[model samples]
Target: MTHRIALCGDLLDLTADPGWQVDAGPAVRFRPDSCLLIDEAGRVAGVEADAAAVDAWLGSAGQRVDCRGRLVTPGFVDTHVHAPQLDVIASFGTELLDWLNTYTFPAERKFADALEARRGAELFLDALLACGTTSAMVFPTVHKVSAEALFEAGEARGMRLLAGKVLMDRHAPEGLLDDVEQAERDCVDLIERWHGRSRLAYAVTPRFAATSTPEQLQMAGRLCAAYPGVYLQTHVAENRAEVRWMAELFPAARSYLDIYAGHGLVHDRSVFAHGIWLDDADRAVLRDARASIAFCPSSNMFIGSGLFDWGQAEAQGVAVHLGSDVGGGTALSQLRTMADGYKVLALQGQKLTAWKALYAATLGAASQLRLEHEIGSFRPGTLADLVVWDWAQGPVAQRRLEVARDLHERVFAWMTLGDERNVVATWVAGRERYRRPDATAIPQPAR
Candidate 1:
């Protein structure tokens, strides 16, 4: 029922979590400089990149896309983002709570207007693709209009997007809070309309425990328990002050993570951001629940939050995924997030290897979101959503990659220094969405 497509490129084939010892099956490793990905009937049909394999796969009769000398990897999975925060990203520096109150909260308030929300959705997706991200898990504003606009934008772009109507019924500005009854109702409506519709998915978002009342948490817990496929997202151990607020709000809870686990909100499909302040007990809760923590290094440092103990998290078997965290995070580049993550570890007498960073952003994050089977790697039968990266897109990057002999080192150099400029092209579902100034089409950079 769908058009068959094949793509030729230097695929970043991965078969395991870079940080873990698990096999990614046959897809775990990429060949040096070639691979073919075929999409048949809207599902991945074949994968092989040898000249003969590709020629045979094409068979002189399939729609073909080619990547010439660019790094082609699976679409990036941004496990954490506030779509409404796009307008306020890179605002003048302020601390976490103050920054939220000053720029973030105020800007998100405007998303209640559907037109404004839609405009934001368009801009946000454009910005994401311009930087070569094909799919993402995002945080919508507390407004239902926000989720509706974001999902619509993702649909238009043919992306695998997961988002939700952010829930908050207390400890927030008046307009941002949705009463518990209405919050769950909105989430149920979103699921009925968007979840599993094409590649669009729904998330049960509670903003954070601090902003949601007990009833709101219980409602989310019940909904997630009933809908196993729906993702549960919230903030945990992000800031000490926020943790303290949660403790005061839920005195019966043993720990902040306990609050969510006690309510049935913690589960295998859950994704929480900012574990910078998490303790052993919190890590245990996350591990027991099989929940993923989106390690927001840039956001942690940007807000003067304490460094995340990556080694510690891993030792405790907690899944770690990287996110830009946008406004609270200082950079739009997940590559930059890698660099910041390294710096955070370095400060804690630890190190973040290039392989670790790449894994966290790509396959590791995808596993956390439970979308790996469909999109995380250049496997046969996966949608042809890919990015073409210019290893030497700019002078500085060119110089860096020159002496870098290893894949991890080269990727690290590029990550620490590159931005959208390194994005040579971006594709969605076998279609060219952003071409970096070639005969096919021109990418209109986000203004």
Candidate 2:
């Protein structure tokens, strides 16, 4: 077929968030023996169509790309990441604050040079695509140069991106912190230029309550309010020391979540990272405000911070999105993050199913970014941000699937052990970005 483009194998889409309770529904909607058809316009024509529909779309006038019977999911969305922290993702043991001082500050300072920031942006987005992450709401360093570098890269690649300048004015190293007035100024400038340009979006990012004084957080809120559809991102109660500092800094506020609420930053579009130490009241407030969370399980476990209660949050109706939390998070792959989330929850006597884990990375993340209508599913008219998964990429993955009893069990085993190797090709808006080298694509064993 000359004009064929179809993603075959297991076609999965997350119809619910991770924090959802098991409803009267099938165990997380799985589509097996499926193929997703996409047109040259980058819209999903249909997924798992009947033989005729698949043949018609494929034979229609467009270039052809095939997945060769691998799992195909909507490209993953990363709700939380530090554009500047990509340099130190697995830096050996440093708690949040110390990590910033020892590694983040010096590294971010290099980004003041636009050339350096651009280099990092290319490397960062390339790494994300290799892991099947099509969209992300990322934290740029305090320098406006950092956001510009990322925006240019996204523009070049047709990426559906959300990014911003870090707003900080207090409790941070001098070189890294921005004054309240200047920080808000940079945000407004970036928002004005890039907030809704193409697939690009801007976020009002206040590094955290600790780094941002009351004045800075209020400014961030004003920026979010001014930009109509812009997003707000920040760290909430991620670590014990951070929580104590939040309590001390915002003594007048009710709790850590309350600090952002007081500034109008807690809205339907806000996504707080590392909600590891939340209480019932905290979950209630976040749910009520409709703000979401980017759960950083790998970062939490890597730093020995605290175990996140995924089960409790979902029961309360608070949406939980997934994040790699790079430099802080151990890997750039969302597949790796899903495995980490599953392991941590299991140890706490809670179970994270394959569907729930996938949700955290895809539609669940799109909901947090309020970009669900555009990305994160196999739904017709959604962007063709698709990933072709290779099930038998390695010995172990192939062995597990060979003996798997059920569909969910097969998917569960894949998420638990899969890495970038399982990702055969990643496409964003129907444009192929990364394809594993032929040498890395192992041939099938004799049947």
Candidate 3:
């Protein structure tokens, strides 16, 4: 059966610009009463402004979704999230290492049961849709079954998801540890089975430098070299204590980033999470390698991790993306992530504009993941993964939007005050995956 959807509304077309590196702000094109046509393959086929043209194009077959007053934008792309740690979100009072020991590792151990893994994947993915997140790069537990569970759930929903079985050889509890050789074998097998399957992709995840021994890191690097386009995700310089520990663990290396670089793990597809404490030399190396960083502001603030210097990172030419880092972070809503990010940068005497924040959650993050051509924007050939935001949903939000004069103010107000309650619906692959019960699209009058 063919599928088609005509979404007509105030659309936010976040087209990419070469000047984004310098400005970090997106060029948002707002097209009111515009109609976007999504074909059966879930790709944007055409965009028309005249209702007559849209009706003629539909020809009585397409499902016309009226979104007159709503704001439609590209679906969010979360660069770093731990699926199993959804159970541990908002745990109080602990920094990086201690938080892992007390809350994260223990929670992940439950994924050893395939049933629990599946259940957790379902819950996490469902929550993501509700929060207007259509895609994400997720970190599952050390268990192979946990990765499988996440992959299966994503596939069922036709979502673009990247996930992997975490490789941790030491420091973690025995239940979560894997021998280096066994870990390598498991990753290879998973890559063969799941990589490039549907919209699912595999990532080689080493649970940061602290837990992985030299041998394990070497194996991880080798796997990346062997597999083309398989992403490598890990932590780096997230906290002062963790950075100090990494320096002690690899004393011969010049810096923490050097440890991964020495093992051939620093490359274009690699995504380092929470680069909060990186020095100039470290940032230089990361920039030269063309690697990306997942700037997890919520997690940094939640776990008492230091602020990420966006100015420093941009100056160093580092590719930066946003992540909820849930559990360690606090909330999965990108709005909250933007709000927290605003607060984090404000304390540093810096500013994050609403355009930059939304771009980071959508196209900016997609570019870092090397998936901009497929998932980020409403470009004609891209996937129709989109979020419909009701700007006038609540009394407070309604009042704010009423008084707002320009796109910047409207977007800033939304980022500063919006939450999941503002998400009217979430669409993945042109299919309505989630819709708020009270949400209603403005109907197109008789034409």
Candidate 4:
């Protein structure tokens, strides 16, 4: 039993880094009235522009989805998000430390209940798919059950998910904390069970330097070494106050990122979120180690955290990508993240070009996760995780799109104005996972 799907639309694919300049060689390939052929194994067969070849693909056994008026691109990859923090979104009036106590901790505590964890996981994944995000690196809770539930839900939906049980042995709530020994055992079990299992991976999630004791942080690094290729995710220099607190907490460390480096956690697989207050020295370390920064713009603005310098990070050769940061951030849509990111950069007298922003959300993020070969492109044999989007449904956006003279201009309009509403359908591994109800539906599959 083979299932194939042919998607005909305005296809856009990023082949290489577009850099900051528009004339950086053939970085992006755009094909109008093109057809994407998904093979039986749920991988991309090719993108055909020839009318006869397109007709032949449509005449084959699979279903032909008419996406004539829409845009198709690789599904977005959210570099940082918290699975247990879905209920924490839009909570008002607090900075990072206080907000965590007020909303984030309380919300995550609910995941101690297996049923609650399961329910939250399902809803979180669905919301991500609805926003055209097919892959994400998520934070569950200190409870082993929370990580298990998230992994289970992601597996059922066939989404690419990287998550781990949080390690927090000190500083804050009692119930949410885990002892270093027990946390290690739990992580080993989870890595054995879920890592490398069907589009899933494990990340050693320490809830930042403030939450974890020195012992726990060292143990987290040890686990990364014990299990080669496991990822490391945590926050860093997100707020001025947080940075000051980290300085006091780890007095001997040279800088905020130095604490992680001291513990042997600075590696190519590490993803440090926020990074608003980091200096050139930190950026150099990240670039040298091949580590990445998950630039969470919406969350930074909402929490009143300082702005991250996009140009500075890029100039220093640090890999930077977008993250929703959910509860602290407003929405799961990467489009919204990019919009906020543009403003973040603008405030610092910088520009986030349309191609650069889109590439960061999709291929750039994938490169950070080391999954670029698997997801993030329309290259033959890559997984067909894609999003079909309507350029504009409202009059204001339609007018803007109508007057746009080039691909970059039209995309800039959509990136600023678009939300989940622009997403008409989402496909994970060539199987439709989400479809807008108000939009005309695709025909049934050919059996």
Give per-residue CA lDDT, model 4, range 1-447, as digits (tens). Answer: 175677889998788779987554588878888889898888899988786776677565667777877899999999999988888799989999999999999898888999999999999999999999999999999999999999999999899999999989888687898898999999999999999999999999999999899999989989999998799999999989899999999999999999999999999999999988999999999999999999999999999998999899989999999999998999999999999999999999988988899889988888888898888888898899999999986999999999999788888899999999999999999898999988775554442
Q: What is the TM-score of each candidate against the true structure?
A: 0.92, 0.93, 0.96, 0.98
Which pairs clash in model 1?
14-28, 15-24, 15-28, 35-49, 36-48, 36-49, 44-381, 44-382, 45-381
Q: For candidate 1, write residues 1-447 as lDDT tens digits.
A: 244455555667566765532322443465546755555555556566566766666565555555556677776777787788876777776777778888999999999999999999998888888877788779879999899999999998898898999988987898888898888788899999999998999989988888888888999999998888999888888888878888898999998888898889989989988878888988988898889888888888878778888889889989988888887886567777878888999998887776667677777777777777777776666777777777666677798899897666676687778777778777777776776664242222111
The window of 10 residues in a row where model 4 has the poorest summed lDDT is: 438-447
Cα shift from native, residue 110, model 4 (Å): 0.4
Error of 1 at 309 (Å): 0.8
Q: What is the C-alpha RMSD of each candidate to the true structure, in Å?
A: 3.6, 3.3, 2.1, 1.3
Better of 2 and 3 by TM-score: 3
lDDT scores for all predictions? Answer: 0.78, 0.81, 0.87, 0.91
Candidate 1 vs candidate 3: which has greater lDDT?
A: 3
Give lDDT tens digits, candidate 3, residues 55-150.
887776777888877888889999999999988999988998999999999999999999999999999999999999999999999999999999
lDDT, ranked from best to worst: 4, 3, 2, 1
Clashes of 3: 0
Model 2 global lDDT (CA atoms, 0 to 1): 0.81
Clashes of each: 9, 4, 0, 0
Candidate 3 residue spans exceeding 4 A from truth: 17-26, 440-447
Which candidate should be chosen as best, given lDDT against the real structure? 4
List where candidate 2 sits over 4 angstroms from the true fold. Answer: 1-4, 17-29, 48-52, 439-447
